[model samples]
Target chain A: GQQVMQIPQYQHVQEGEDFTTYCNSSTTLSNIQWYKQRPGGHPVFLIQLVKSGEVKKQKRLTFQFGEAKKNSSLHITATQTTDVGTYFCAAHGGTSYGKLTFGQGTILTVHP
Target chain B: EPEVTQTPSHQVTQMGQEVILRCVPISNHLYFYWYRQILGQKVEFLVSFYNNEISEKSEIFDDQFSVERPDGSNFTLKIRSTKLEDSAMYFCASSAAVLAKNIQYFGAGTRLSVL
Candidate 1:
């Protein structure tokens, strides 16, 4: 079994502040995916990281994969009230096609 | 934009009763999956289906749980005997192809309350 650990289970920040959450895996991951779930909604695909040390940005959000491929991070710059939600980092270990092991998720609350 | 759609946004069942959760994945997607999340908890993978068969399943998917693609468009998860611990939000997801590279799109999820 694989395990994904996420840091800062909860975070509350001013609308203009920055936020970062880290995900760590006990076993090496083939690829990592990021998902966001709003207050009563389902998980929505945010981004995926495949290459080691990969960095991708979507407007104010930035995602990074560690060089070892065992960890990843998501950073949000200048968060807004609409950014309130739970962000989860998921990965598929071994050869388990689409069986994603998800981290506990970081619940972010942006206060205006 | 196309998305996964699940039926009956909420379900209430009694322990030992049978329950079925339905989902309609994206038309062109090749991979379908089921995941569950307890209130305010992380999403947990239950099973993944491809080409009309299960590709992978987690330990949580035991004999009490089953999956079926009854038709070209419908994917369903059945709990033979629901238990109190089975209460959770079940999500249906789909991916285009090559699970390693593609992103999975999730449905709104069905909140199951087993009493």
Candidate 2:
């Protein structure tokens, strides 16, 4: 069975601070996707990285996929009150079609 | 922008009663899935449905669980006999296709509580 692990289960920061969450997988993945779940809301897709050693950015958020395709990271340049939510990284293996193995999310708390 | 929609934002039932959770996935999507999350826990996959049949299911989706696509738009998950442990937020998600490049869109989940 494949498992995805995320580091820093919880984080707290003031506005204008930077935050980063790391995700690692026990098996190599075909692609990795990042999602954000607002408090009491459904998970929303943010970005996806399919190529090895790939990087993508959306405004203040930067996402990277490792060269080995076994890990990924999401970094926020400056935290805002609106960024308070749980960030999850999901991986799909070569044989898993669209089924995703999600990591234990990193809960980010941004204080104004 | 179309989004997945789920019915009965919250449900309450007895321990041994049966319950059905309903979802209407995005119209153009081809893949459907069910996931559950306990309070303060990670979301766990339950089953995946495509072409009016189940394609994949997790151990949690045992004899007590079943899925149905009765029509072109509705996908439902039925629990034969609910238990206290069955309380959680159940989410329905859909993807345009079964490719690594496709991203899933999730609906606001149905919260179920078994007393």
Candidate 3:
């Protein structure tokens, strides 16, 4: 079994402030994926990191995978009110048949 | 863009009753999955289906739970005897087979409340 841990269960940031969330896994991960779930909505796929020390960005959001491949991070710059939601990091092992184990998630609240 | 669809946005049932949640995955996707999220919690994987058979299932998908692809378009999860613990939001997701990274697209979910 694989365990994924995320830090800062809750985060409150003023609009235009920056926010970051970290995710660590108990075992080596083949790949890590990030998702965003809005209030009363299902999880939406944001991006996935496959290579070690990989960094990808989507607009104001930047996603990074640790060099060891067991950790990852998501940083949002100049957050807007629309960034209010929960960000989750999920991963699956090499043998898993597409079964994704998700982290507890970081709840982000952007105050206007 | 196509999307996964779920039926009955909300369902309420009594304890010991049987309930079925239905989902229609993206037509072109080859893998289908079901997950549950207790309010304010992370999404937990339940089962994964491919080629009309279950490829993998988690411990939570025990004897009380079963999945079936009765038709080409519908995938269903049935709880034989529901308990209060079964109350959660059930989400169905689908991913394309061509990609190595299975990016699952989830449906809005069906909130089940067991009284």
Tens digits of per-residue lDDT for model 1, A60-101: 999999999999999999999999999999997657787888
Best by TM-score: 2
The candidate, 2 or 3, that scores higher on TM-score is: 2
Alpha-carbon runs more than 4 Å astray in model 2: none
What candidate 3 gets wrong by more than 4 Å, as runs, is none
For candidate 1, give the DockQ: 0.82
Please give fnat for model 2.
0.74
| Alpha-carbon deviation at B87 in model 2, angstroms | 0.6
The residue-by-residue lDDT of candidate 3 on A1-112, one tens digit each, is 8889999899999999999999999788999999999999999999999999999999999999999999999999999999999999999767878999999999999999
Enumerate residue pairs that collide in model 2. Answer: none
Model 2, position B115: C-alpha lDDT score = 99
Candidate 1 interface RMSD (Å): 1.3
